[model samples]
Target: MPRKERERGAHQREPKGRKQRKAPSEGKERLPEDKPEANQLKTEQEKEVKLKSTVVDIDSVREKEESLALLEAAEQEDGLKNKNLGVFEWLLMVFALALVLLFFPFSIWFCVKVVREHERAVIFRLGHRLQGKPKGPGLLFYLPFLDVCHKVDIRLRMLKVPLHTVVTKDLARPELSVVCYYQIENVALCSAALSSLTSVLQSVVQAAVRDVLAQHSFSHILLHRRRIGEKIKAGVDSVACRWGIRMERADIDELFLPVELQQTLATEAEAKRQQQIRVSSCNGFQ
Candidate 1:
C-alpha cells in the first residue's frame, strides 16, 4: 500500500512538471506569431504615412491651381469690360452726331476745324487715340461732343534752359545758360508722347550741358565753346529722337564764373601781360 501511494504521487508530480515545460514551449511558438503581427502593423503604419504625405502635396497643388484659375477669370472679365461699349454711350454718341447734323452749315463753325499748314490735329474719340496718321492742313469735320481735337504745331521751336551750376574737371564751378532749337519730326508722337515739350526739352538740355561741361576744364570749355555745344546737341538729339523731336542746335548762351575765380584769372592775365612786355623790351634792346 505504501509503494502504490508513492507511485501515484510521483505520477501527479511528473504531469505537473511536464505541464510547466509545455507552457514555456507554447509561449515560444506564440512569439513568432506575435512578431509577424507587429511587422504587419509597422508596414501598415508606414503606408498610412506615405498616403498622408501624398494627400498633402495634392491638396497644395490643387489650391495653387484654383487661385490661378480665379485670377485668369478676373482678368478676362476686366478685358471684356474694357473692350465692350455700353448702350448709353452709343446713344449719346448717336445723339451728338444727329444734333450736329441738324444744325447743318451753321454747325460747321464747331464741327469743321481748319488745321494750318504747320499745325496737326490729333483726334481722340471716346478717350482713345484715333487710328491712322494725324489730321492736318485741311477741314476736319466731327461731332463736337463725341470727338476732341488737340492742335500740335509742327514748326520749329526754341527752349531756353534755366541757369545751371556745374563743377568742371578743373574743380571750377560755373553757372551756364543754354538755348536749344528743336523741330517736331512726328506731330502725332509729339502730341501723344510728351505733356510739356518745353519743360522736357529744358531739362534734357540742362542735363546734357552739365554732363558735357563736367568732363572738360573751365579753360577748355571757354576756348572750345563750339565743340562743346556740338557735343551737347548730339546728346540732346539722341534722346529727342525717341520723342519725335529733332534737335537743331544747342548753344551755350552765357557762362558766369565765381567772383573769386574771376579775380584770380584777372591777376594771372595781368602777370602774363607784364611778362610779355618785359620780354618785348629785352628783345628791342638786343
Candidate 2:
C-alpha cells in the first residue's frame, strides 16, 4: 500500500529547485531564448545613437573651427587695412614737407636784382608798375603775394604801330594801319610810369592817330597814311622821351577798313552805275 502511495505521490510532489519545462503543445513563451538577440539589437541601437551623437559633435566642432577661422581671417583683413592707413598717413606728411621745400625757394629768387651783376626786375606790384627797378635773373626776394615779374628787353625794342583811318567832320571812312618801334631807355621810369608797357603805347599811339587823322579828310588820310604813321611816331617819341624811352621808328605797313565799310563802298559804286544809266536814258530821250 505504501509503495502504491509513493508512486501516486510522485504526481503531487512539490516542485523544488528546477523550474518546470512547459510542453510544446502548451505553447510556452521563450523569453530567455530571445534575450541575447534583444541584447544584440540594443547594442546596435546604442551604437547607432552614439554614432549620431559623435557626428553631431563633429559638426559642432567643425562649425566652431570655421567660425574661428573666419574670425581670424577678418582680424587679418582689419589688420591689413589699419597697416595701409598708417603708411598712407606717413606718406602724406612726407609729401607736404617736400612741396614747401620746392615752391618757396624758387619763387623767392625771382625778385630784387643783384645789380652788381646788372640783372633787373620788371616788377608789377598789385597791378601797378615798380618803375625803374631791375629784377634778378639772379637770386632775389619779393613780397610773394603782391608782386609779379615781367622781363624787359635791355636792347632795342620794336613795337608794331597799326595804321590809321580818318573820319573828318565829313563822314568819309578810310583805311588805316601802322606800327611803332621803341625801346626802354630808362628801366625805372618804364616800370614805374606805366601799369602795362603795351597799354601805355597803345593809348599814346591811339591818341596820336586821332590827332593826325582829325587834321585830314578821308582822301588825305588814305593817301598819306605812311606820313601820318610817321607823325604818330613823332608824337610817341615825344611822350616816350618823358619816360626815358626811345622810339626808333613808327611806320605804316597796312591800311584798310572793316568789311562793312568795303561793302558800303561797293554799294556806292552800284548806285553810281545806276545814275549813269539814268543820265544816258535822259539824254537819249531828249
Candidate 3:
C-alpha cells in the first residue's frame, strides 16, 4: 500500500466516524425541545386515563345507588305490610272485645222475652204457677234458672180432629172429621191446668164428637148438621172451660160412608125423585 493512500483512507474513516458521533449528539440535543410535546402527550394520556377511571367510578356509584334504592323500596314495602297487619289485628281485637262486652252483659243480667200483641206469657216458678195472672201483650221478664215461661196464643186457633168412625142411633156406621175454633180465655189457667194441652184438647174434641154423634140417626145427622155441631160445641166448651179454653165454633168438616151405603142412599134418592116427577106429570094430564 502507498503511504498517501493509507493517509487518505485514514482521513476518510475519521470523517465518517465524526459524522456518526455528530448525529447521535444532535439527536440528544433535540430531545430537550421534544420534551414539551412528550410531556403534553403524557398529560393528555393521563387525562384520558382519569376520564376512564372517573367513568368507571361513576358507573359503580350509580349501581350502588340503584341497589340502595331497591333495598330502600323493599324495606318500605315491608314496613307498610307490617303496619297494615298491625292495624287489621287491632281492628279485629277491638271488634271482638266490643261483641263480648255487649253480649255478655245482655245475656247474664237481663232475661227479656218478647210477646206479640196476640200472645200471653204464663210464668211458672219451680213448676208452680205464679201469682200474677199472666204477662201482658208487651215485653216480659222471667228468672233464668228458677222460673219457666210458657207462651199462650190469645188469638183464635183452629184444630182439626181426625176421622172418627161413629155408629149412629140407627146403626149406620159413618166416618166423621171435625174442625174446632177456640181461643184462650184464661192464659194462666190454660197452660197450668193441662199436662198435655194439645193432646188433651184433641182427645176431648174427639170424645165430644163421638158422644154427640152417637145420639143422632144417619138421616137426622145429614138433615140437621148445624144442630149436631152446636151440641158438639157445647160439650167441648163445657169440658174445656176448666183449662181456660173456650170453644168458639165447631163444624163437621167432612163425612164418609161405606161404598155400599153410599150407593144405596143414592139409589133411594133417585127413586124418590123419579116418583115425584111421574106424579107431577099425572097431575098435569088430569
Candidate 4:
C-alpha cells in the first residue's frame, strides 16, 4: 500500500511540471497591451519608406531639370551663332554695294552681258545653279566675282561626220560620210550635260549610220537612200533626245564603192543598154 501511494505521488508531480511548462507558453502569446507598440513600429517603418521614395523622386526631378537647362543653353548658343552669321552676310552685301557704286560704269561693263536672240545664258551663283529658267535675249546683269555664266547657242546646228567605213550585209565594204542637222531644245541640259557636244554628236551619228547600214546590202542602200536616211535619223534622235538635242535630219552626204564593185556595176549597166538597143532595132525592122 505504501508503494502504491508513492506511485500516486510521482504521477501528481509530473503533471505539476507539465503545467509549469505550459504556463510560460501562455505568457508568450500575443498581448493586447503590447499591440500599440507593434503598431507604432510598423508606422515608423512605413514613414521611413515614404521618405526614401520622396528623396529618390526629388533627385530624379533635379537631374531632369539640369539636363533641360543644358539643352536650353546649347540652343541659345546656336541661335546666337546663326545671328552672327546673318550679320556678317549683311555686312558683306553692304560692302559689295558700296564698291559697285564707287565704280559705276566699270561695274556695268564687267557685270552686264548681252545675250543674242539665238543664245541663252545659264547662271551659277556661289557654285550653285540659279533655280529658274535660263536668261536670254537681252541685257543680263550678275555679280561680277560671285557669279559665273555659260552662254549656249540655241539655234540650229550642222554636224558633218568624217568618212567612216562600214561593211554591208552582202559583204561589200563602203565609205560613208553623214550630215546631221540638229537644234538644242533645252539649253540647260545641252550646256551642262555633255563635256564635248561636237564629239558626242559625231560619235552618235557614226554609230547610227554603221548600225543601220549594216542591215542592208550595198545595192539596197543606194536604191532606198531616203528610207535608210530616215532610219539613221530615228536612231540618232532616240539618243539625242536624252541630251536635249532634237535631230532635224540625218542624210548620207557621200558614199564610195570599191573599185571591183564599181567595175561590175558598170558592165551590168552596159549589158542592159545593149539588150534594149537590140530589141528596139528588131521592132523597127518588123
Candidate 5:
C-alpha cells in the first residue's frame, strides 16, 4: 500500500470514533436546554387557562348573587302588598257586620207606613186608641202585626136622601128627596162615632126633611123651600159637630105629588088663568 493512502485511512478511522462520543455529549447538552424552554411554555399556557377559569367563576357567582337579591326584593314587595290588601278586606267586613247589627232588628221587627196628603191614619194598639189623635200625612213606623191602622178620608162628600112619601100640615101627601153636602173635620172622632158616616148622614137628613115638611102647609113649603133647607142644614151641623163632620149645605132635589093631585092642580090653574083673561078683556073694552 502507498504511505499517503495509509495515513488517510487512519484519519478517517479516528474521526468515526471521536464523532460518536462528541455527538452524544452535544445532544445531551442541547436536550436539557430544550426541556427547560418547553416546560416554561407549558406552565405559561396553564396559568393563562387558570386565569380565564377564575374570571368565569367570578362572573357566575356575581350573577347568582344579583338574581337572589332581586328575587328577595320582589318577594318582600309582594308580602307587603298582601298585608295591605288583607287589612282593607278586614275593615270592609267589619263595617258590614256593624251595619247589619245596628239595623237588622229594626227591619225585621218594625213596619213602615205612608199616608197620602188627602188621608189620615188612626192607629190602634190591641183594639185601644193611641194617645195621639191621628198620624201625620207622611212616614210612620209601627210594630209589625201588633198595631192596626184605619185610614179616613178628609175630603167633602155628598149624601142623597131617597124619595119618600110624607104628609104635610094641609093633609097633602108629597114625595121628596134631599141632597146634603158635608166634609170631615176630625178623622179620629168621626171614625170612632160612626162606622159609615155617609149612611148616617142620609138617614138623618131624610128624617129632618120629613119633619120640616110635615110642620108646614104644602103651599107654604113649596114657596119656602130655601128656608126649609137652611133649617135642615143648621140642625144637621149642630149634631154632626160631635161626629167630626161639618155640614156644608142641604138642598131639596126632588118634590113629587100624586098623579091625581097633579092633574087636579093643573085643572085649577087653567081655570084661574081663564078667569084672569076674561077680566083683562072686560077692562080693555071699558
Candidate 6:
C-alpha cells in the first residue's frame, strides 16, 4: 500500500485479538486532577451522613440514661417513704404500750384501803345482806373487789336534841331547845336498824321528845325544864337501847314566847301598871 493508506489502515484496524488502547486526542483530553477532586467530594458527603447518624444515636442513649436515672430515683424515694412510715408505726406502738404499763401501779392505792389501829372497821360484804363482824386493832386486809370497809368511831357521840313550843295542856305555846348525848351499844342491831343512820337517829330523838312533851304544859317545859329533860332522857333510853344507841343526856337550851304572844304580854303589863298608878293617885287625893 502507499504510506498514507498504510497509516490509515493501521489506525482503523486495531491489532488482532489484543484490544488496542488509543491515546486521547488533544482536543478531548481528561484531566487527572478532576478525578481525585470528585472522589474527595463523595468521601466528604459520606462522612457528613455518618456524623448525623452518630449524633442521633448519642442523644437516644443520653435520653435512655436519664429516664433510667429518674426511675431509679423514684424507686429510692418510695423506699425512703416506706421506711419512714415503718419507723413511725413502731414508735407509736411502743409509746402506747409504755403508757399502759406505767399507769397500772397507781390504781392499787386509789381503789383500796387498810384497817387502822385503835379503831373498828365494819365490813360490808357483797351478797351477804348483813354486816360482818367488826374488825379491831390489826393489820387486816380489806377486800378490794367484793367488800367495803368503814371506820366506826368507838368514842361516845354527843348530839343536840332541841325542844320546841307545843300546844300545851293550858293551851299555851312555849319556845324551847335541848342538847342530847348518845352512843352506839349493840353494833349489829345498830348497823341493821336502818340503812340511813342519821335519819334513824333523828327519828329516835324526835320520838323521845314527842312522848315526853305530851305530859307537860307550856310553863312546865320552860320553867321546870329540868324534870322535862330527865323524863325525855328516860324515854330516849328505852327506844335507843334496841337500836344500838345509848342516851347520855337531854338538856334544855333556850325558851321564849313567840312575837305575837310577847307583844300581848307587854301591852297587858303596861295597862295593868297604868291602872295601879291611877288607883294610888286617887287614894292620895282622898
Report the number of the highest-TM-score candidate.
Answer: 1
Residue-wise C-alpha lDDT for candidate 3, range 47-112, written one tens digit per residue? 999998777565677567656644654453333221223565456546655655678777545567
Candidate 5, poorest ten consecutive residues by summed lDDT: 76-85
TM-score against truth, every candidate: 0.63, 0.41, 0.55, 0.61, 0.56, 0.52
Candidate 5 residues lying further than 4 Å off, grouped into runs, are: 1-110, 269-286
Q: How far is candidate 2 from the true structure (C-alpha RMSD, Å)?
A: 33.9
Worst 10 residues of 1 by lDDT: 74-83
Off by over 4 Å in 3: 1-109, 266-286
Q: Write the per-residue lDDT of candidate 2 for residues 1-286, one digit (tens) a residue.
A: 9999997777566342123444442344566667889999999999999998777565677567656644654453333231223565456546654654577666445434443343356665545454334665576555544556665566666666555555653465555566778877666555555677887887787787777777777667667767877778866775666565778887766767656768989999999999999999999999
- How big is the positional error of residue 282 in model 3, measured in Å on the Cα after superposition? 17
Task: Report model 4's TM-score to 2 decimal places.
Answer: 0.61
Residue pairs clashing in model 6 are 163-176
Report lDDT (Cα) of residue 127, candidate 3.
54
- In TM-score terms, candidate 6 sits at 0.52
* Model 1 regions more than 4 Å off: 1-88, 269-286
Candidate 4 achieves a global lDDT of 0.82
Q: How close to the true structure is residue 220 of candidate 6, measured as C-alpha lDDT?
A: 68
lDDT of each: 0.82, 0.64, 0.78, 0.82, 0.76, 0.64
lDDT of 1 by residue, 164-273 (tens): 78889998999988988889876666666689888888888888888898899999999999999999997787677766688898888989997779899899999999
Residue range 1-286, candidate 4, lDDT tens digits: 9999999999999999999998977777757658889999999999999998777575677567656644654453333231223565557657777888899978878888999999999886545556567898899988777678999998889999988798899989899899989998867666666889999999989889889988999999999988999999877876777667789998899999977799999999999999999999999999
TM-score of 2: 0.41
The alpha-carbon deviation from the true structure for residue 20 of candidate 2, after best TM-score superposition, in angstroms, is: 99
What's the distance in Å from true for residue 218, model 2?
1.8
